[model samples]
Target: MYLTSKVVIEKEKIKKPRGLQNTLHDDYVKCKEECRKIEEREITEKYIQYLKTELEAAELVVAQESAALQATSIVSSNNQNENKLDQVPSEDSILKSEKETFVQEENLIV
Candidate 1:
């Protein structure tokens, strides 16, 4: 019985070192994971800032394009109106032409 008790104590002593090593390994893994989380958070923050800057630049481009489109439309509309005016005779010219036609016709008949 004494020999058996001595063997059991020896076995427990051996198991104690393994348990301590496992505990130390677990602590090391936990610390590594925590550090990784912090690094990931910093990378995420930088990425968010980059995306925000890109978004702002895109918005500025869109605004500039919209302004350009508006100006082009305004100029196109003004040109179209000018072309329409050129195609149509003025009221005063039409009335004067009609009066000359009547006078010539009356002179010819007389």
Candidate 2:
């Protein structure tokens, strides 16, 4: 009877350590899962920041191109106006030609 009680006491001690080890394993898994969640959140935030920077750069490029296009259009319009001005005769030259035509007509009538 004495030897049997000693064996049972040893078995109880072994079982206690096994239960503690199982609880420790569970805690370790939980910590690893939390760490993974934090890492994923950080990566998502970095991606969002990268996208925002790209968008701002695209907007700036678009604005610069629009301004350049407007400047080109204005320059083209001004050049067209200058070309039209060059083709038209001055007022003084027009009056001189008209007076010459009138004198010729009077001579022909005489």
Clashes of each: 0, 0
| Clash list (residue pairs), candidate 1 | none
Query: lDDT by residue for model 2 over 32-97, one digit each (tens)?
Result: 999999999999999999999999999999999999999999999999999998887889989999
Model 1 scores a TM of: 0.60
Q: Each candidate's TM vs. the true structure?
A: 0.60, 0.63
Candidate 2: segments with Cα more than 4 A from true spot: 1-21, 88-110
Worst lDDT run of 10 residues, candidate 1, spans 12-21
Residues 1-110, model 1: lDDT tens digits: 99999999998777555537787798988899999999999999999999999999999999999999999999999999999888878899899999999999999999
Clashes of 2: 0
The segments of candidate 1 whose C-alpha lies over 4 angstroms from its true place after superposition are 1-8, 11-24, 86-110
Could you tell me the TM-score of candidate 2? 0.63
